[model samples]
Target: MTKVVFITGASSGIGKAIAEYLVEKKYKVYGTSRNPDKVKDISFPLLALDVLNTESIKIAISTLIDREGRIDVLINNAGKGITGPIEDTPTEEMKSNFDTNFFGPIEVIKAVLPYMRKQKSGKIINVTSIAGYMGLPYRGIYSASKGALELITEAISMEVKSFGVDVVSVAPGDFSTNIAAGRYHTPVYENSAYKDSYAENLALMDEHVDHGEDPMVMAKAIHHIITSKKTKIHYKVGGFMEKFSVVLKRILPDRVYEKLLMNHYKL
Candidate 1:
């Protein structure tokens, strides 16, 4: 039987790229977007899903299962970006960021795990970020959320391994996507003490994104992970420097690594 793959936030960007790539590879692909109407001229079926809404998630998952009978792979790729000083960010806004980036994926995992466990085989990939390993300057909350998910993915991998389900976290550095269109900025940044630094660092962030690797690159990496017989617990998808930075963080002294990051971001 052809494998069934369900991906969230598949309307565009990395998620859409992954879904399309999998479909081209002959996997039965079902994608979910907050507004299905927005996904036009797509080759795969798009289901309406708002990850923040529990009912929406349930409906989307059930709709796919009803039609496909099984979901062999689940890609929790739906996430939003937020950038700002942590101190200047409001409590509610921080929670909202966690809701989308952290809680949303957790909920999806829960919804899919039961079916996966029943089959005694499945793969769950959480599309985290390189920023999760080392928090970014102006995007503290976004990093924190991804960091949290990374740990969750690690812990859950062991917890579900006995059931023959494999879970892994795929952290990608900057990718060429319109993520900025959905990015949120802290309201207090304009008047806060970090305003000037925030402005400069935000510009640097945008520049990195503008020149980031193509989404197709990460999509191909994800495909490799899905098809490989030997699975890794964590995968990093990005340019050489970006992937190497994660290595340097592991070996460099605290102050030394800190200096490198600070200099890279011009902090």
Candidate 2:
């Protein structure tokens, strides 16, 4: 029997790449997009899903289960980036960021856990970011959201171990994707005291993301995680420096690591 795979944010970028690759690998793939009509060009089934909407998630998952009978893999890849200084970004904006980036994935995971638990086998992969490990200057909210997801992934991995369910967080460093186009630029930045640095750093960050590695790199890492018999709780994928930075955070002193990030961002 073909293994059933479901992925979120499959309309474009990393999610799209992963869904496409898995289809090529001959896995029964079902992907989600908020606007299914918009993603009609994709090869696989693009179910309408707004991760922030509880009903939307439940319906999408139910639809998939009705067709496939079981979901072997669940990829929580739906996310959006929100950029601005911590002080300048509005509270509501931060909530929106967490709604999609953090709470969204949690809901999907909750919906799939029961199915996986009963089957005694499943793989859950959450796509996080390198910023989750360290609080970036202007992208604080985005980092916090990813950081929150990272911890959830870790905690759930332990909780679900007995059920034979594997939960992993895949932190991708700057990947060239359409994330910037969808990024929420808090208007508060225009009137804040940190406006200058915010603009400079935001622009620099966008440049780096635009020049980042191909989304296929991320897709490959996820494929490995799905197929491997024993996978780590966290996997970092990107350029060497990006992966090394995570290691530095673990071994370096707070001040030293802080200085390094500050210098790297030219802050």
Candidate 3:
């Protein structure tokens, strides 16, 4: 049987790229968005799903299952970016980010596991970030959220492997997407302690994204992982230096690594 795939946050960016690429490969693909009716000209079915809402998630999953009778892959790609000094960013916003980035994916996975277990096969791909490997300045909460999901993917993979289900996270470096526009930012107030530095770093962040790698790179990487019989718990896709930073964090001393990040961010 040809595999059936479901992707979340497929309205744009990396998720859309993956959905489109998979369609070209002839897999039965279903994409999701908060408002599917607004997105047009897609090659696959785009359903309405809001990861933050449980009922919405349930409906989207069941709708696809009812129509196709199976869901072979679940790509948790719906996430929002957040940037600002930790002190300046609101605590509620931090929790909100976790609700979408961390809790939301787990909810979707919970809804899909039963079907995968019954069928004795499935794969989950989580779109994390290279930022998750370390807490970058002004992006600490985003890092923490994705980092938590990365570990959750490991635990889930171990628990479900015996049931013929696999879970993995793909952490990408800067990508040229509208993520900057979608992300929430704490205003850089002139009187605030981090005003000048935060303002400069925010500009740098946008510059990195403006020149970031293509979303197709992530799409191709996901395609390869989905097809590979053997897979690792964590798969990172990005420029050589971006990926190497993860390795350096593993080997470098704590303070030394901190210095590198601070220097890189010009903090």
Instruction: Work out the TM-score per prediction.
Output: 0.97, 0.97, 0.99
TM-score-best of 2 and 3:
3
* Best-performing candidate as measured by TM-score: 3
lDDT of 1 by residue, 155-209 (tens): 9999999998999999999999999879997654456898788888888888989
- Model 2, 48-152: lDDT tens per residue? 999989999999999999998999999999999998877777899999999999999999999999999999999999999998988988889999999999999
Candidate 3 local Cα displacement, residue 145, angstroms: 0.1
Q: Alpha carbon lDDT of residue 160, candidate 3?
A: 95
When sorted by lDDT, best at the front, the candidate numbers are 3, 2, 1
Which is the leading candidate under lDDT? Answer: 3
So what's the TM-score on candidate 2? Answer: 0.97
Query: In candidate 2, where is summed lDDT lowest over 10 consecutive residues?
Result: 186-195
| lDDT (0 to 1) per candidate | 0.91, 0.92, 0.94
Question: What would the per-residue lDDT of candidate 3 be over residues 1-267, giving only the tens digit for each residue?
Answer: 889999999989999999999999999999999999999878889999999999999999999999999999999999999999999899999999999999999999999999999999999999899998898999999999999999898889889999999899999999999999999998998889999999999999999999999999999999999999999889889899999999999999999999998999898
